[model samples]
Target chain A: MTAGAGADAGVVVGVDIGGTKVLAGVVDAGGRVTSTARRTTPGRRVVASQVEDALVEAILESAGGRHLAGVGVAAAGFVDSAGERVMFAPHLPWQGEPLRDLLEDRLGCPVLLDNDANCAARAEAHHGAARGAASALMITMGTGIGGAVLLDGHVLRGANGMAGEFGHMQVVPGGRSCECGRSGCWEQYSSGNALVRDARALMADQPSVLTDMSDGHPDRVTGPMVTTAAEAGDLVARAAFASVGDWLGVGTANLVAALDPEVVVIGGVSAAGDRLLDPARTSLQRTLVGVGHRAVPRLVAAELGPEAGMVGAALLVGGDGTRTAAP
Target chain B: MTAGAGADAGVVVGVDIGGTKVLAGVVDAGGRVTSTARRTTPGRRVVASQVEDALVEAILESAGGRHLAGVGVAAAGFVDSAGERVMFAPHLPWQGEPLRDLLEDRLGCPVLLDNDANCAARAEAHHGAARGAASALMITMGTGIGGAVLLDGHVLRGANGMAGEFGHMQVVPGGRSCECGRSGCWEQYSSGNALVRDARALMADQPSVLTDMSDGHPDRVTGPMVTTAAEAGDLVARAAFASVGDWLGVGTANLVAALDPEVVVIGGVSAAGDRLLDPARTSLQRTLVGVGHRAVPRLVAAELGPEAGMVGAALLVGGDGTRTAAP
Candidate 1:
């Protein structure tokens, strides 16, 4: 195999099963998506089989009769250290489901499974940002934050394949309740949900474009609405990004203190780009320990954008059972 | 060279330079100290050479004219990734000092230097509680919190050699101020200083044995005094452990959430052992994300106790400059 993603090997399909959508892409050897299909995600409230059906539909739609090298599936959940079962998913109706085998049997091909953030990191490490770094941290800020750690270009899957769960780390004690049944998680203050929440909280006190955009209902304010208004130079929307970005920096500073990566690549809800990163970078520099004495890691937006998860998953088409096990 | 510590190799000296003391020990290959010496730490208020002088005096006293394999010095500071200079230290008056060269010059032998927490982790991974674990997180709760991360039996020093600096992670925003100039550092709530601070705060509420033990001077209460009184079942002192231990578990939970190591070995002011671990463990279980769904890393006490740092430093005696260098 040649260097750089082994792209000439064959075409592979990657599927990212997120909270609200099932996204599938047919990725060429050069880490480019040739075709794509999307399906509404039957979320955590639905049966596991229904979600699997949606995944199957999207995968087949994306395939478009192309021969497949294999399929890599990225899920928003606690993938077992073996990368075989989805022990639990905060957004998906999965509980110890052997997702790989089930998908393989249905599709008649080798199937690989990993965390969504790991897939995004793989995409970035191979073709996007965080390239050629000895160590990197990938944080995807969509919905809730998802994290992955790469050391020497390989994902450092901890004892349970659950390392890099940065979002749930407590940034504020008893500050905000999370769906994970914890309070004050980093994601609670820094993700898309957090962006929307802050916008709504700000709407309660002042006049804002968001109130009109969301039809005067705070609950209807979405992440996209806030980003759009922020781009249009709305003060309230800008305030939300500032608050969320500052918190993003605060949480990242905590991680930087512990992991000291070469760079941190942010993906998922990163459409705001500099609007999100500038504040985050400022706070990262302000809060990191030994700030002036050591190299401050650079914080940058992810190069792969929304397609990163699927592109990274597609890269896993090759074989390595080092962290893969099936029962 | 042999199965274990290579005890047949030769005798080496290990020195741990802390904010309060310079502890030196002559350690054999079996990780046992044959002789020990201690001197007061000159601290951040003094010049770097004065601190270095104290270290030299203690190392000579411990050596007692025995032949030496080499010397390994562990500093409670940010040792650069090359293990050459101490970039900065909180308690010691070191600011990017060429510590290894300084020690090697005076002693006329090879000198290895590393962060004290990294040294402690090496000792535990080799001969103590975390032995045989593929991935381990070591948190030393002494005057402040120190952390180290090991992957595949080697320390994962980050891009700046500052990985595993877990103590500065912010658990409470705008909380307590730390010497590092950051507010709400994890150590501010869960270390020896935290123990003393909490004990003193409790003393202000009611008449406790600590009040009499400190001679009614709340500021005079020390970590050992609190530990001693807690072991003796003093209610107020026990309350302090409950607070510190719970915070310990809280900060550890954050680290575990991020690193997800196979084991977490806590040392340093771990003298309280169960009094510290039991409460920490309970809180860890309650706070860890996906707690029941994944393998919760076992939190254990450091077996080598205070000597782990010196022993680990000694382990660096015969090594390639894998992460070591001197100018």
Candidate 2:
């Protein structure tokens, strides 16, 4: 085979299944995405079959008659060390299912699977936030928190490929119980859920300006709503964001203390702008040990946005797994 | 150079200096220690000259008349990334001193410097607890705490080479003020100091048996004393250890969540058999975020003990940095 052909021979179809939608694309050599398609994620009822059908259709559309290679899927939850099974996913229907083999069989190609956060970090390391970084960590603060680590330009997949669960790190004991069955996990304090929780809690106690905006419906307070109200000079909404920012800083500080990453890339819906980041940056520095004396990692927002998982999934599918997995 | 010699050519002298003693040895290929010697660490009264002379003698003795290579000295505190200097060491006399050059001139050999905890981790990764492991963290819970990370068998020396300062991570906000001027650092709640703090606090508040044993002299109730009291079934001492264990588990859980290490090695004086480790292991498992479902990294006591630094330093001095540094 020609050098270029051999290099591109492993083109894998990448699929990113998020809570709200499924995005699929063909990723080839040099980390390029070909044809792409998107569809809403099916409801819990008949979700498995619906997701599979949507993924298959997306894969077919993305191939567009081109020579297909393998398939790579990035979703939430713990993936096996082999990157061929979904042991458990909080957001998806899959639990201890051999997803890779099933997808490979349907697509007529080999398949690999990984945590979505890991895929995002891989994508960033290869082409985005961590393009030329020596060591970096990407943390997505959304509905739930997701995280990825890239060391020496390579993703650090732990023994079980369950690495980069940065959101679940315990920030405080007996604080708040998470859906993951753990209390005071970093995500419960820094994620979209945490933001909404904070805003709702504040609105419940104090008669705030957001009350008029929400028409006295406390349940209507969402992450974006809090951000908007904060920007519009709402005291309770701003305090909620600041509290989440403090937790975010605490989480980042803990990560830095452990890994000493050269850079930390913040992503997900929470990274809408400087509204959440300013407080996060200040708190990260304030909480960091030896803040002034050491070369603390630079905290920057992710540039690739929602597409990071898609690109990263493509790379994971197209490239050899050796580069992504730690030695 | 012959193949065998090429792999082992950089035989740098390595020394592990601690509060109570100093250890020096000749490290060869494959992390073997050839000549070894130890001496009581001189006090601050006759600091610089005494320490320098001791170091020079150790290096010459360890060499055993072989053509000497460079030196790798591992000490405490925020070690300057440069192979030639120490920025600040709280326990030691020097500050921003050209230690490498001074040692080089004294012995006419190039020298490399690192934090002693990092040296211990290198030793463990190369030959002890974390051997054959791809990703792990080594924590020395001594009079204070020290930390190091091994990802894919490589040490993560952050942008400034001071990456693994884990003991400084905040476990509790406004809990306890550390010597580093930070309040509620992990070390304050989980190290030897933590044990002492817990014991002292317990003795003062509760009518513990230790009050009778030490007769209200908190200084007399050392870590070993607490261990002895616990072994004899002293409830308060056991409770104190349990508290430390919980914090230990918390700190380690934080580390695992942040770094996703495949193994965690607990070293230091406090890890004297099962007194500390039993609770540590239980607490670690309980506090771990995805404990039962994921490939949980092993939490085991270190086998190398105080000798780890010397052994690891020998390994560092003997081999090219590529294997451990670049993996």
Candidate 3:
């Protein structure tokens, strides 16, 4: 089936469930979000029912009496190959949860669940920076690095649908410890969290505008604050960005060596446009194997922003023709 | 067309061109080598015509007057996407030479050219360790690391045929100098060359059987000698194998994080069974991302051994229905 199908008679509901927020939208076949709704995600300590309640509310508000063809949930977790269950979600209350069936039952429509990064990659391949490319690598650098690979216009969801976890590839031996019980993961040096961590360390040692922005509490410095400070010409903030971008390039080089995609699209909060991509481009060229002899894949910023995940989810449900069976 | 076709009527010749040796074989549709021939690769300083002559001689000897359907050349170099010219071969005297057309003219049959690693990976997917796997990553650890990826049985050749140069991926920040003009490439720590390098370094500092095996010259220690010594319970030799295997595992972990294949097939000389893979297995588990939560791809040794490249090349020509057009 063609991608982003159902452009004429039907609309799909796309819900993006993150750790702190849930964003839902009614997307038509053309990838247009006609209606949107947002809700604060309940804390992880809350019951699974509470989280489900938040998702249901967001979908209901977004649907707003529209005839829905299918519903897609872009979740921040490990989605199973069948798109029926969430095996684990670090920040959400999901462990072997049948999220797809529950949503289908509640909404009375077909539902498909997928990792947010995969959804975003599909979105980019269908309508954004990676459009028309034979293959692409999409990296969403938020709190940590999340990745998705599109090969021949299909998401390469490994054997267990857990492929493209590029962040955890160890770059340094016995270096920075990670929550996944590993050290020197690419994310430790290149993600949004890495940017803030480096910025805070720089703040501790040097005088910078970040100290004032964080109100003298370096611990309170978030990723966005550092980006803001860097844009204002803060040396420490810019240095942190440079460090992260360098590591991003190193990791991209490793990916290119392995996958050899036609283009690499950087998304999520760290897409900081030229701030992150310029240094990444330089480092990627410097570190890439056979740089002088080989054709270097284009490195570009993602065209779609945060809304990419929701739109991609909607498209996947509408296009792949995999709808929930009737209750 | 199905892979390894033409089992009933015509046979194909597969030729593997390496730095030191050229191996050619007559392969039937069942992936069996009926007749084989070998020759010394002319030194790189020799003219390109001499190298081509050596390959043609091997093919003629292997064909033995049998009706040939096609001939496939698996060269150790950067082959372009069209499989007609060799962009650059490190150890061969070829630069943008139209090897395919030249071979077809001499052989009076169809000809196809491809990277040696891609040929080997294709062989495994069709007839060996990676058979039946939905996706597989093949790592050939000879003097250096060569890699190939197969998805749904087709080799992922990337935009250019230069996608599988896994040896050049920098694993260390500034560790060992590589022939590719890079530092700390995976090959520096993990290939057959790495094993010999480590053995020599150990022989320099410590008393070991390798010194005696090399006739008191540490520089003369070869990869096979070290492997044989390690099999004989030599500590230094075992340590070298362990070191190479650990790096192999680390590189495998990086590949898994990006590709997430169902199985990883280790081929080439270093597929010395458990000597390399046992240590690789331990390190792969230790370095793999989401170790406990995600399914660990089974790691297995290649089934076809050194003959895989030749066999795969024959299969590529016999299958895919792409042959040199009759002039």
Candidate 4:
């Protein structure tokens, strides 16, 4: 924690507002957290005001005797260039909600907002995983796929302030129906949801050990359960993981062909260590276009773990807000 | 000419060395041509040393009495980072050729080399169709498809300096074989060759206006003939343009979904004054992934015409080897 005092004592508060949980931390200039707090996200029907109030409360609790420099909130949705409003968030009840303005008013400080994946990318670029790289692409595979791009030591926000929507890129024409009302999106094949769906489908077809592995409770077939079963040499779970890995490789290959970044850092629940990446690496080489001609961007697991968004949020306050700063 | 003289007064020569022709011009600092020279390309069987000598002669002849600043050559294939070598050009017999050193020695001036497409994109960004834009994707649809990406006013050269090889991006798996040993690339559907192939294929099977349009010479079908027939309202030729336009839209949509540039400039023989671009514009929206959600990047024909690459080459010299020196 002593290292935190050397960088900049802006006393930044990092908040990761995810679908499953709301994690907040008070970070010093050197990226050390002095106080932390977490809470389950409000229910599906919760209003924007309620979520805003909860976010403000969490910030105050985490602040604990520290003066605030600025606040960074990582929300799961499309954030516009201004970083004050949420354009869209399917999992959250924030449609065109001025989350940044609301938070700033409540906390008495400047606020910056960005997509969760972009937040994770910034964190990796600032402190872990993709640190010191000129360019990198961060992919977070959980219930769904999420992505962020860092170009020339900064994030690439496209013309409309919307880039790195890589999860929505078509991986298959008619593979699976995504909640976005599109089929064959990268997320549907290479995500935690994809793993669970494959596991359930496999269990239904052949009476595999995974069905018995889950003890006949088909509904209990989770991503981690499938991973554990695969590690234990279960055929169905292994197949499911392999399927996810294959799709991961396909998506990564498309990404490499398009962006040509120096490195790709994989995170999220599906990446849980190396099970997903091993197959992904094998498939990446196989599916990669112009294999031997171009330099293959390195694929590595994210080193910052799940708390990367929070750390990145804290780092944003200390780093250049040139583009990712509060408007 | 006065505008050219008003800028920096120092002239720089631009040489375009293609497989079929070698074109050189002395370009003033303001993009005005002072003098010009042209010659047919030398035999491909000879070593690059002979070819370099021929190009140097053309450049010196074009230079005439102009006090030169430098020379920028737009080679037909992949050019290295230093803009001094032709790394690989399948159509042209050049492999790891030190083009700049050879030319600088012969021409007695500093030399810059870059792929024709990159130079074309740079040209459009500086003084052509994409002028004043923050970013753009330039697609040159000639006998082959060539591409370049301009980001923040600089051509985006990837890790291996081979980033803008968009024509080689696989559009269809195992589809029409290419000379690059690939199948179903974007260029296969949208290039000049694609136009002729589709026109010939239509002439053979479907009984349509193409037979009468071609004046019974079915074997002599060409891109220009199709353009003329399309203007005359030939259904088959219109269909051919539509087909190419469809693929152009698909390829451009893929790019739009990835880069999200402010504009997409269509150049080369296919653009032949918006005959191709009219349908391309309509199809681009239809094929766009998030059609209704995002602002579509403007699709336009190159204003600098076929000389875009040559003009861009001159601008490189005018800028004195610093690519981003111009507006």
Between which residue pairs do clashes occur in model 2? B12-B70, B123-B312
Tens-place lDDT per residue, model 1, B1-327, is: 111123443357889987788899987657778889999998798878999899889988897876555788888888998888998887887888999889888987778888888988888888898888989998988778887888766777889989888889988889999998989999999999999999999889877889888898999999889988998889889999999899999999998998899999998755788898999999999899988778889999989987888888877776321223321
- Indicate which candidate wins on lDDT: 3
Give the CA lDDT, 0 to 100, for residue B194 in model 4: 91
User: Residue B39 CA error for candidate 4 (Å)?
Assistant: 2.2
lDDT of 2: 0.74
- Give model 3's DockQ, 2 decimals: 0.75
- As a whole number from 0 to 100, the lDDT of residue A282 in candidate 4 is 89
Predicted structure 1, TM vs. truth: 0.90
Best by DockQ: 1
lDDT of the candidates, in the order given: 0.84, 0.74, 0.86, 0.74
- Per-residue error for A143 in candidate 2, Å, reads 1.4
The alpha-carbon lDDT assigned to residue A106 of candidate 1 equals 92
By TM-score, the candidates rank as 3, 2, 1, 4
| Weakest 10 consecutive residues of candidate 2 chain B by summed lDDT | B1-10
Q: Candidate 4 chain B — worst ten consecutive residues by lDDT sum?
A: B1-10
What digit string (tens of lDDT, one per residue) describes model 3 on residues A1-327?
222335444567888999989999987667788889999999688889899999999988897876566788899999987788999998898898999899888877778888999989988888888998888899988889998889766789888888889999888988899988989899999999999999999989999999998899999999889888999999999999999998999889988987778999998743377888889999999988878777899988888898999988886674544563210
> Per-candidate RMSD vs. true structure?
3.5, 3.4, 2.8, 3.5
Ranked by DockQ from best down, the candidates are 1, 3, 2, 4
Give a tens-digit lDDT track for model 4, residues A1-327: 111232344467889997878888987656666788887788558888888877877877787756666778888877876677887777788888988888878877777788788888887777777877777888888777777778755777677667677766654544578777666667888889999998998898877677776789888788778888888888888888888888888777766765667888998743356778888988778766567766788889887787888877665564432223421
